[model samples]
Target chain A: MTQNAAPPPKLILRFTIIGLVIAILATAFAYVGGWLDPGRLTPDRMINTLEDNAGVHEGYRRNHAKGYCVVGSFESNGNVDSLSRATVFETGRVSPLIGRLAIPGGDPHANDGMPPIRSFALQFQLPNDEQWRTAMNAMPVFPVSTPQAFWELLKASQPDSQSGKPDPAKMAAFFAGHPETKPFLAWAKTAQRSSSFVNVEYNSLDAFRFIDAGGTTHFVRWGLVPEAPFTPMTEAQKQDPDFLSRDLRERLDKGPQRWHLIVTVANPGDPTDDATLAWPADRRQIDAGIVTIDRAQDQADGPCRDINYDPLVLPDGIAGSDDPLLSARSAAYSESYNRRTREEAESATSSTQEPRS
Target chain B: MNPRTAGTFSLPARLLHWLMAIMILTMLFVGVGMVATVSERHVWLVQLHKPLGIAILALVIVRLLVRWRYGTPALPADLPPWQRAAAHLSHWALYALMLAMPLIGWTMLSAGGYPVTLFAGVTLPDLVSPSPTLYSALRFAHTWLALSLFALILLHLAAALYHALIRRDGVLASMTRSRKQP
Candidate 1:
């Protein structure tokens, strides 16, 4: 009979109220700390800041200034019905896909064989004015999660004026503070550079969601895996300035160069918000379709030259993930598109005026 | 000899209770590590965290099923109504959170387009579509649930201590000590 009994109802009610109050307060704190509101940071301002700090090259893109355009057809096997509801995924739908493959750098004249990350961007125009655009990179993961952090990374990595070399102290400090960049750096230092763009597997670092007609939804990230085996360049091959683009052109002349589009689906408890984090390889993957490049074109006069490959241009059944970098890229690409297009327009008028004068 | 079964939890219930305790504590620490560390190990820790969460979810399911099948021992007659209600509420809350946190985590990852890799290279199917909006909501919910679970655990621990040390009651022994019923 000395055992303790349950407390009265009033006391229980009081405890419950106290617990709820604490929960609400904690939620408020998280919101104030910027965990709940991911959109509080703007991509436009970050892009402009990068341009100002990095010194914008007048007619060139803020990044990936060097590229070669190509024309291709993305034919669907119509077997994607179970995975996607978009018409582009339907069988026998042969839509024109314009693409650009480039070595990573701000200078358009950067040597082709110089070791650098490669990029592959594509624009798929479907039947109903729906466009699916994506830009892929050789790097599996990005360096940072947010635009603000990306700006900081750029600032930190900037070479000192007097030395014309990046300050090791600044880089060390940056790396020490930002451990998320470690995996990428480790891979970059160890990975051998591919001799040709076609030999590289290009990844769309951001994740996207696809909804099927049955109201089923899947979170997916895609990559264009090259059929060409990877071959590192020799010293002789490194001497060629346009080796990648030139090799691609020659191969297209012989026959269509192809790549497989593979989409990986996410499981429970996976990290989806950070592009810097990679998903484990054993995850479920679906081979959606094949992308065939039947022709090559020069960037100066190519259809893809002026086209902005905003990754957010998704068709029905496809949508953007919560990765902050995805939206940031979309904004930055549009900004670059507007600025470059404006500069081209002005240059056109100026050349006409100069000839008249 | 029958002290455990007469007024204490059965052997299976006691084992599951301790197992869950260790797992929940480990989960709290791992959750903190996942956020606090930025090293290469952070990625490894995240990989570990996913499987651990799924394990907790699975264990909690079994624990609940066992509890439902085999009724718990009665509380002491002297225990106040408020205290009894509090104990019942807290226990159920812990169970709810254990089930929810992992499921929410899975849904969040699915929405964000990341794969949840369990131990032994197994991956579960996505339960929802990838939408930035939905992903954000799930992420927020997961964090909150973790925090709530943390708070509830602390309260539970404090109550357990009060029972064991201050009351000198057999309540704590019910789950801790296992012996055949008289």
Candidate 2:
């Protein structure tokens, strides 16, 4: 038995060597077949290539048609400096843009007027020579920092653990997990109590790089100051919840509702990397430009509602800061986009097939 | 000849299995790490993340071809039918995910209108339209799938360990070491 086992061990050894060689050969073949190209996997390069190809295919035309394209149109006005000064670089590009407006609840039709913080993600196309840019959520800070924190928050904020209704205790647990959100929590809590008059100021919570004409760089935060004065909503106003939307609609109907898009430059000497801290209002307020909203068009009926807003889309001059959140966002956004599109394509194909009699 | 012991896996099968195992595991680890450490300062990780993903993508294709040409080894006769089915299903899912994740990532990057560079400045062609909404949904799916894949792998490992140590079956040894009997 020992003699027989020894011969088997040698055979096994020979087989292992051959297996290793085969694997090496297989990997080599794959590498040469364009399957191993790293460029295809890297976020930045992948985005750039996608954008360039989209440009050729005119795929972004619908995105541009959305209101965000107005940023690029401003360039034709020869007011690039004024535009640069007043706006966050993310809001300045004219690339096709995508925005998602959600009710912040599991239900699609959850009360729209519940003082939910409306998220606005703008993907602006940079000029031919510029990098891409994306601006998001009105707050300069997010509720959570890490993915685990985000998960915790989601778990807490999710409707009743069993019933699927908003669970206050869970929400509290989420808040407790991250003490840093005290300021944001305070703001959200207060805002939720207010009526139609609630003053919602969007913060560009992430820091971004702004390259000036002289090639000097400044890290900046963008703040949106509605031209209209602040009005706090009453309890009655919350009952009618669509009041904010109606207000926006009424203002747009009366005339283009405008907001002063202000850029607060980071003090070069101070160099604060975290966006949670607000730049003191005393910081020089550069007039980037007026963001004029031509009466709230029926976005429900428009192409704007259908597009995605990815932060990685930067025009040439405006570049993303080395924010890990930005990279994660970019990667996550890319993955989401692919899956959705594939599903859409699949559904479309299925729909087009002839039905069984 | 040792009649009591079972025959081992062929050379090509064992090599493909381990090579793919290392690459897949590395890719999963890198992916989780990348998502977890998202800060502007971690540009180096981002750089490493993309290339590693591409490497996994490349290796998966080769693994698939080899798998196709030479099928997996048959299970031990003592192995239960359900366990065998579970093993096959899990392997197929892993293969599918290995292929799908990179392809989706590549297309998503393309749609965002960015260049896909590997390492020392090489770039790949675009694969889709630059749609932000599309990018977001795909990104979400990618993360979710990755999480699922991680869970599946854990289960796979648990099962293998159970068979190897508890059952004292030769299942794990088939892949870990050569199975050629004299």
Candidate 3:
């Protein structure tokens, strides 16, 4: 089998080329196959840990499992075209929106009042026929900066079975190790529980790079500031397991709920990569547009259920920043999406679409 | 009766070869774009991808039947034993991937519980049950196979060009439309 009628020219070159291809294949497999990766904390590992912490709810999002779908429209105010050439920012143009509002944690049946953080995920159908998706939270900043620290935080904060609360010593050690979590945790402790989802400001805590028509780059964090009166949840409303969903439906039934889309531009020195840090309050804030939600539906069968809502899913003018969490979230979210879509998810409550129960 | 010394490929064989070559290359680019992109732009690529894959699947099967009926031109006698063996193995790999890619993609999508929707809203039946772990494994396999397929194609192109240009042999032309005997 080794004999040949003639030997091909450049035998050394051919062997070298073969060796290089094999090397490239090995490296690629090492990356996707795990073990050879540096951090050992891969996206698959993160989701597995999450399932261990909070058992999986079939056919639902791994995080923020319980939520309702929203149908809305966003109107650009003509101010952002200079900063971002995205077609979504065409002056006076309105784009269709589908979104969701939910509390944090994997348990699909968690109480609305218990979780301090609320999440809003949006899918924007831009004027140019492209789509942009983002997952924002009500917190001004995140508790942990890196995915590794966040994973550790999840493990450390597991509640004691008997007491139904995390061990104080374990939390103390975690806080010391990750001092970055202190500020966000403090904010959570003092932040008032809003009675309605419309009253809260949903912040895209991770900054993104926006490229303008002139090829100028700006790092920006954005959020929706509600026009609705900032009201606290009433004691009676707190007793209802479905208060947030109930309140949202009731408000939308009467009229559209509105929020100003505020895009915050960062200064040259702003820490765009650190989720645990926030830029100064006086930084350039652009009143991008008004977001109006006209109606709501059950997430189970609604348009929003199938969407991944990946934060990194940006349009042409936007790109992900160097934040470690950006790639981390994208990977974990993809894994979560893959897992949930495969199951025949069942909504526990069907009578009232107010909440999936 | 030697295949290499025979006249060029038949009209139908030549047509199918070029047609499939365009399709398979487009499929590779589309597959790469589908995974790298995060925007809703990927939505269109994905929609284009499913139907393209189904088309290639159908064409490849027809291609095998055509080959069975008409037969291929044999390799040149003067070609080195190693080169001949390499050519044989790579061609086998190409056929294997052409069939396996669409099938694996269909199975992966099925395991992920996604509809194998094609043109005119025709959906293929699921080949397997929905299981997340199984879905992930299939996805991984599909990616590796595509990479391998892409690598093989590059090598195939290199070998064909070597015969056409450097070797000045008629091996490449045997597959082409030219009827002139070598």
Candidate number of the best lDDT: 3
Error of 1 at A16 (Å): 49
Q: Write the per-residue lDDT of candidate 2 for residues A239-267, one digit (tens) a residue.
A: 77466556555554676544555667777
Model 3 Cα lDDT, one tens digit per residue, B74-155: 7776677899999999998999999999999999877764546563225577889765556766777888899899789778
| Error in Å for residue A229 of model 1 | 0.9
Question: Which candidate do you rate higher for DockQ, 1 or 3?
Answer: 3
The global Cα lDDT (0 to 1) of model 1 is 0.72
lDDT of 2: 0.53
> How far does residue A35 in candidate 2 sit from its true spot (Å)?
20
Residue B167 alpha-carbon offset, candidate 2, angstroms: 36
Q: What tens digits encode model 2's per-residue C-alpha lDDT throughout B1-182?
A: 22222655667777767777776766666565444333342345556767878887887787777778866666665556898799889988988988888888787667655655554224566787665546556767777887677667667776765555445557777777765444
Best by DockQ: 3
Show where candidate 2 strays beyond 4 Å.
A1-11, A17-106, A129-133, A192-199, A213-216, A234-237, A241-243, A268-272, A295-301, A352-357, B1-182
Output the worst ten-in-a-row residue range by lDDT, candidate 2 chain A.
Answer: A65-74
DockQ-based CAPRI category assigned to the predicted complex of candidate 2: incorrect
How much is the lDDT of residue A119 in candidate 2?
A: 50
lDDT of 1 by residue, A1-357 (tens): 453344434555555655665567456545543466655443445556556544666566667777888888887777666778877788777888999988765556768876468999998876544668889999889878876677677677676778855688988898788899987888888888787778888998888888898868888888988888988876777888878887888888888888888888899777778888899999987777789988888776676766778776677777777787765676566556656655655555567531100
- lDDT values of the candidates? 0.72, 0.53, 0.79
